[model samples]
Target: MTGDNAVNIGSPQPPQKADVLARVCAALSAGDADTAKAIIDTDYPMVIGTKAQRRYTLTETLRTFYRDGFLDRYSGTQLIHPGALRTLSMLLPKEFPAHLNGKMTETHFAQWELFPTIDHVDPVARGGADDASNWVTTSMLRNSAKAHWTLSELGWTLHPPGDARHWDGLSSWFTGYLTDRPDLASSSGYLRRWLRATRVVQAERA
Candidate 1:
């Protein structure tokens, strides 16, 4: 698969809420529940663009959402950039768990004003040696969603939604936890850690 067809660089313009939603849809269509969860769990903050001034309040809201299982039921159909949608479809079935079957489709593609745009590069230019190298280099970005989401859940008690501090803390915690459990690493693990750390941090803050 060519890189253009395999991964979406997105528009040079910053992604809007709709754009991100489309990406989530594409991720789901590809049966990538993990990616979908990461989008909701991590990108929501980016979309909200909140500051770090009220760490404790922000963290609490995020933790509450997770604790209440709001996220588990937040599934929906979304539009995706065509390249990304195709790429994700090719990738997800091989990688994701079976429980998320049929979650991705074009049915809701237009509902959220999310749609795919064509990229300049040939999507097929994505899987050769150079592509492989680039993929490895970029793998960190893909792997980070789960870590960021986990950290967000954990740090929710300290930072507000969209706070950069929360993202930083999530990255730090993810790195620390993944160092010990590389094989067990996943969005689910991140959620569990968030729950565990939230209690610990709450006690400290208390």
Candidate 2:
């Protein structure tokens, strides 16, 4: 990664996928249980709630909670202060597999080459969270090409086999996932302002 946020590293030859994933796992194991319980659940989704509910891995679910500034979506009266979830996310990072389901980044990665980019189906610029519901894996090439463009704006379609190659599939699936929690769809105006403030700070450094 470069010091400049706006600059994309071309032909960036970085670490191997296994090495990167291992490090990510290490950082996660060190986090709190609320974060770990949701992540370590390899089974993911455990089970999707009525059609109203969408499937997601523990990791993505927690990322969403953190991104949206919450302790847990199912928990009542517990909330993480605004931007705290993002703060924690910045400190303790995770990735979304190419597949929205836990299968995206499974134990066997040798089969799926090219490291995964766990990106938000929705952009944080527009109030997207880190939740699995809003996240997906894609080629770094596709991600760089996508830069800030919404799924529909890209005019891509999802195939029935559920291939991750289609960058647009992530967004389409997320739209359905949000059927259960539309409130999580928009980050608070507070988050938008905070993001802008931080970007200015970053730009000053750049």
- Top of the candidates by lDDT: 2
Q: What is the TM-score of each candidate against the true structure?
A: 0.17, 0.25
- Model 2: which residue pairs collide? 38-58, 60-132, 64-131
lDDT of 2 by residue, 1-206 (tens): 55757556576655554555565577577875455454434323233222213345433433333343322111111232223333333334453122323263332231122223445556655556645656654433455566666677677442221222222212223334333444643544534444444334324434
Candidate RMSDs in order: 23.0, 22.7
Which regions of candidate 2 fall more than 4 Å away from where they truly are?
Answer: 1-113, 159-206
Model 1: residue 76 alpha-carbon error in angstroms: 41
Per-residue lDDT over 1-206 for candidate 1, one digit per residue giving the tens place of the 0 to 100 score: 46656655464544577778888999999999899889877666533322222123324433433232221111211222222222233335445322223244522322122221111111122211222111111111122332223323433222222322322223344335544654534435433454455445344434
Q: Candidate 2: what lDDT? A: 0.40
- The Cα RMSD in angstroms, rounded to one decimal, for candidate 1 relative to the true structure is 23.0
